[model samples]
Target: MRARDLLTPFPTVTPGTSVIDAARLLADHDLPGLIVVDDEGLPASILPGTQVLRLAVPRYCQDDPALARVVDEAHADALLSSLAGRAVRDVLPGRPRELPVTDPDATALEMAALMARTHSPLVAVVDERRLLGAVTLKVLLDGLLAQ
Candidate 1:
């Protein structure tokens, strides 16, 4: 199957989108990640849920996994509240992730290869810089495993 055939309508956020909104979108859709679209409506980056969680966990806790258990879980929950004023771009790491994009006509194997090479959970299917939809890992696996 081609990317266009496999893709499903997916939500997108701009670089200026609030982290709170983006987090909510992820939670509501139960997505592995949301594609970040540029002002030109082109695929920009992938905002993985893990990266958002990273914003809540203290640096010390990340540095030492055991210390996470020592801290009160409530404090960690409170930190998530602090993300309100921040934008999606703020959550991106210092070194940006490569945009995982596939052409609409690309084959399933091509999409799978791109996901594997980039370690991304979803691939945005774009046609001339315009996003058509996305092919998620689960969808791809379902198609392949159905064989």
Candidate 2:
């Protein structure tokens, strides 16, 4: 199957997109990540879901996971508010990963190779410079393993 054949519409966020809004998009769509598009509508980066979680959790909790256990549910609920004033660009890791992207005509195997190499859960399917959607790992695996 071609990459486009496996395409599943995915969400996107801009550098200035609110982090809280981006988080809502991830949850609402149950996505593995979102494609970060530049002002010109070109694929610029991939924002994996885990990265959002990293932003929500306090650094102390990350440093010592046990510290998380002591935080009450109310506090846990408040954690999300931390992202209120932040934008996607502000929270992105200092060094972004290689963009996981594929051409519309690329073979499924080619998409798989790129996803694995980049350690990304989805690959953006672009045609020339246009954003065409994406092919998620789940869809690709299901197609490959089908009888």
Candidate 3:
């Protein structure tokens, strides 16, 4: 099957989107990550859900799982306050990871390989800079298992 066959509508956010709002979209949609689109509506980067959580959690707590337990729910919520005014672009790494973009005509196996290589949970299917949709890891796994 082709990557297009496995494609499904995926959520996207702009670089200027607030991190808190982006996190909400991730949670509400149960997505592993979001595709960050540039002003031209082209895929610019992929924001992994883990990255959002990393921003919310304290740096000290990140190194020590035990420390996370000591932080009360209120404290945890308070920690996220830092994300209030921050935009997604601000938190992105100095060098963003390469985005995994596949042609609609690409085979599922090819898309899977790209995802594995990039360590991305989803691959954007784009044709001539126009995004068709995305093929998620779950979809790929199901297709593989079905075969």
lDDT of 3 by residue, 1-147 (tens): 898789998889998999999999998999988898888787888767887888888788889989989878877768768789899998876554567888889887898889888888899889887888899999999998899
What is the TM-score (0 to 1) of candidate 3? 0.91
What is model 1's C-alpha RMSD? Answer: 1.6
Model 1, span 1-147: residue lDDT tens: 889878999999998999989888989989989898888887788767787777777899899999988878778668778787999888775545556788888898998888888878999988975889899999999998887
Error of 3 at 120 (Å): 0.8
Q: What are the per-model C-alpha RMSD values against the true structure?
A: 1.6, 1.3, 1.5
Q: What lDDT is obtained when candidate 3 is compared to the true structure?
A: 0.86
- lDDT at position 56, candidate 1: 72
Cα displacement (angstroms), candidate 1, residue 123, comes to: 0.3
lDDT of 2 by residue, 1-147 (tens): 998788977778999999999999999989999899999887888877888889999999999999999999999989989999999989876655567888999998899999889888999998978988999989999999994
Off by more than 4 A, model 2: 95-97
Give the poorly placed runs of model 1, Cα more than 4 Å off. 94-97
Give the alpha-carbon lDDT of every model: 0.85, 0.89, 0.86
Of models 2 and 3, which has the larger lDDT? Answer: 2
Clashes of each: 0, 0, 0
